[model samples]
Target: MTAPTTPAAEALPHQGPAAGTTPLIIRVHGTPAGQGRVSFFGKGRAVHSNHKKLMPWRAAITDAARRELAYAFPADAARLVDGQPVPILLGAIAAEITVTVPKPKSAPKRLTSWPITRTSHDIDHHARAVLDALTHAQVWKDDAQVVEMTIRKVYPGEGIDALDRPGALIRIWPIPTEAVGR
Candidate 1:
């Protein structure tokens, strides 16, 4: 069978975001994930095996985020569908991502908080994956729109819901143009 497609905007109402409003916020739910490695082949070709496996998983998250955005701002979604050039946000922008992983049983009792994670998986790699997914989800015109970003990967602290599970919390916002120095 073939994969399904995003419904056409014509079928949906034209409801985008307001001219001046709270910046869009999307929570991708679940442990923040990363991208797969690229394996090189002869003649400079490359392939990503993990990507094929992760496609569906990533698409699910993207689709869910898009749905939420559509529900929240139909006009905005339709504006994008109308082929309006994405007025790439100018000035500085910031993004914050918190990757919460379940604590392991092997942990010592002395630890009372989520410890910083040091892994081979680069934090930017995970952020790239998320940005790519969000771009596909139409969270924005492009990932380059983000100028400043802060990311963290750690086990959820005690009393935190993620302590029992794993998930990602992402925040994207635009900085006032006046706030920019350059």
Candidate 2:
């Protein structure tokens, strides 16, 4: 019997980026019960007085994210840059933030999920809270380094086993150095 012949290499489509070229990425899993902090204003228009309580919340979440990153990249986290600890993630970055809230019990019995959150917290507000925390945690050199961002907020839908839980999932990756057009 004749041996089977392989198809020409050119016949196959390029499925993805070349191996070894994938951008460095990190994922920070969040608590199911955490709520994004809200910005508020205090009497006399003092920013510090208005944000005193919120600062602690931001710090706690930032610490959590920092710990996760360090756990995954101890060596990188320990590295020094210009005599200071290096921000493991650097360069232009892209971030995707997905916030999950528990399904609203007040909805009609037949409605398992709402199309969107109608609460006082806007999607941008949630994103800002996280981004600010990330900046504080030094996930990157600065929040300004994030050139692209996508944020979404939704309540648990049907078949989502973790409906009782709520949290945010953050995905961050460095944009290719050459792609920055700097």
Candidate 3:
């Protein structure tokens, strides 16, 4: 038996979408969530649009993720091809992926950049991991970005902090020091 203080807190989509032929896609909201989208895709764009160079393609992460899921999880052939009805117990079959929008611990006044891409499963998975990383400051890699999330700076603890700090990438640029001084 264990005493409960605060809620256990629901686990975000840690694994692939749900277990089924239908694909699962998850969209996370918050600082890292937004930036992760841009970075992972490796494209710069309008505040809410994805240019061709990017991975997500500007249709909203949910829609983009759904398409990704469709490829990852094609319809069951045994039922559809073999001419058998999907069992009633399973309910209408469609890919089911959940996006988790956790409340922020703190928020930044200004945001600078987000990684262009995660490069794992799809755009959605990377977003969740990137945002989570930004929140926890566990993982950050200064990558040469042709798009978004290409250059990542993950902060550890302290919510609503500098995951989106301005010019964070500019600092990472290869600037030569000790010039014209002595």
Candidate 4:
């Protein structure tokens, strides 16, 4: 199937260093969900894991990534290799993800800038969900392509931050080929 064309795509240069330098930013507006633990079911002879709790969150992230990618890259820019479509950003990637969760009702009003130390979900679990969603969206070849990642979890209105809503802000930069293995 052919890719869709748009005015924005037509206006952008077909080839340039901009793609490499400019980071793709995606703002997912919703309560961020952490990756759940693997839960096994059935008896010893037939045990299987059920890890579906984060599916909704993952789907949201995938949708947001897809929209951001479409806005950043031309639809026709996709290349074919071995009969499969290749993602625009190839090679290693550096990602910075900021997850903002809602302030707990139990938190004191004066404690607006404090960290969330009592939460059950860890920051790494949230990062995993986002990374997996990006992979599903084909933002890159695989999640393994992410060589550098910085993830932070915070409550809304924390530490001079303007994002008062519960969500995640993801920024992905393509690492230049020459910068790898150094």
**Of the candidates shown, which would achieve the greatest lDDT relative to the real structure?**
4
List candidate 4 stretches off by more than 4 Å: 1-20, 41-53, 76-85, 115-120, 160-162, 180-182
Clashes of 3: 23
Q: Estimate each model's TM-score.
A: 0.65, 0.63, 0.18, 0.74
Q: Which ten residues in a row have the lowest lDDT in candidate 1?
A: 9-18
C-alpha-based local distance difference test score of model 2: 0.59
The C-alpha lDDT values of all candidates are 0.60, 0.59, 0.28, 0.73
The positional error of residue 49 in candidate 4, measured at the CA in angstroms, is 9.0
State the TM-score for model 3.
0.18
What's the count of clashing pairs in each model shown?
Answer: 11, 1, 23, 0
- Return whichever of 2 and 3 wins on TM-score: 2
RMSD of each: 14.4, 8.8, 20.5, 12.1
Give per-residue CA lDDT, model 1, range 11-100, as digits (tens): 342122223645555555554446768888989898655666456546756876677677776766555435652333444456766666
Point out where model 2 deviates above 4 Å. 1-57, 80-84, 108-112, 115-120, 157-164, 178-182
lDDT of 2 at 181: 32
What's the CA error at residue 140 for candidate 3, in Å? 35
* lDDT value, candidate 3, whole model: 0.28
Task: Evaluate model 4: give its lDDT.
Answer: 0.73
